[model samples]
Target: AQSVTQPDIHITVSEGASLELRCNYSYGATPYLFWYVQSPGQGLQLLLKYFSGDTLVQGIKGFEAEFKRSQSSFNLRKPSVHWSDAAEYFCAVGVGRSQGNLIFGKGTKLSVKP
Candidate 1:
């Protein structure tokens, strides 16, 4: 079965420091890549996504992700980290054509240090 993996269960970064959250997917064909952030008691907010055209996709909140077919990775990156960025980040792959056919990773918890 196709799945997504976030190697780091949790990560800590100092304020104003750079951040990179890794995401890898295992699928026979090219899959839709997505990154979402969920704050405490809040719904998931889309950070970025990669469909077809661009290898590097920009998202809201200064987040970006690069899709590397060779590595089967769609890692999310931010030049600087903010205290409010503390949340659970999820990397997902669309298993099917439908948007609902998403398989999410266990998620990586981000902690912003002061």
Candidate 2:
């Protein structure tokens, strides 16, 4: 079984400040990690994904995540955040060779202050 945990329920950051969101996963085999963001009333958008190769993977919207196998963590980072970046971010783990159903964590809502 694969599961993801996002410890932070919410985060508030000033616009232009750096941000980082933590994510942890538990899986029997090597897992596929993804970060998705959703606006107030919109569908989720894939931010980034880590399947293999380089531990660090870049994502859309100036986001990036590093897969730390030692810690079982795939944390998202942004050097500078914009007001538009405010949204609910979810960490998901997908199992199997094929793109399997994802087990998502409780989302971390980001609030941007001007």
Candidate 3:
């Protein structure tokens, strides 16, 4: 079965500080990996995705992720987080023939200290 695990359940970072969220997955083939951010009372927005080719992929809102096949990980990174960045971050994997639905890891809630 395909699944994703996020080690950290919550994280607190001061504004303008670096941030990193860890994610690991288990899949039979090269799965479609994605990072999404959800704010209060809002739907998730795609941060980044890895389909194939280059491992490091850039994303919106100053976010980036690297797909490590050996480790089965796709970790999200941001050089400097903003106060508005305080939200929930999720790492997901799309497996098999599933088109829109994704298998999401327990989200990591980020708290930005002012």
Estimated TM-score per prediction? 0.97, 0.97, 0.95
Give stretches of model 3 more than 4 Å off. Answer: 97-100
Cα lDDT computed for each candidate against the true fold: 0.95, 0.96, 0.95
Candidate 1 lowest-lDDT run of ten = 94-103
RMSD of 3: 1.1
Which portions of model 2 miss their true places by more than 4 Å?
Answer: none
lDDT of 3 by residue, 1-114 (tens): 889999999999999999999999999887899999999999999989999999999999989999999999999999999999999999999876557669999999999999
Q: Which segments of model 1 are wrong by more than 4 Å?
A: none
* Of candidates 3 and 1, the better by TM-score: 1
Query: Cα deviation in Å at residue 49, candidate 1?
Result: 0.8
lDDT of 2 at 24: 98
* Best-performing candidate as measured by lDDT: 2
Any residue pairs clashing in model 3, and if so which?
A: none
| Clashes by residue pair, model 1 | none
Candidate 1 lDDT over 1-114, as tens digits, reads 899999999999999999999999999987998999999999999898888998999999999999999999999999999999999999999987864688999999999999
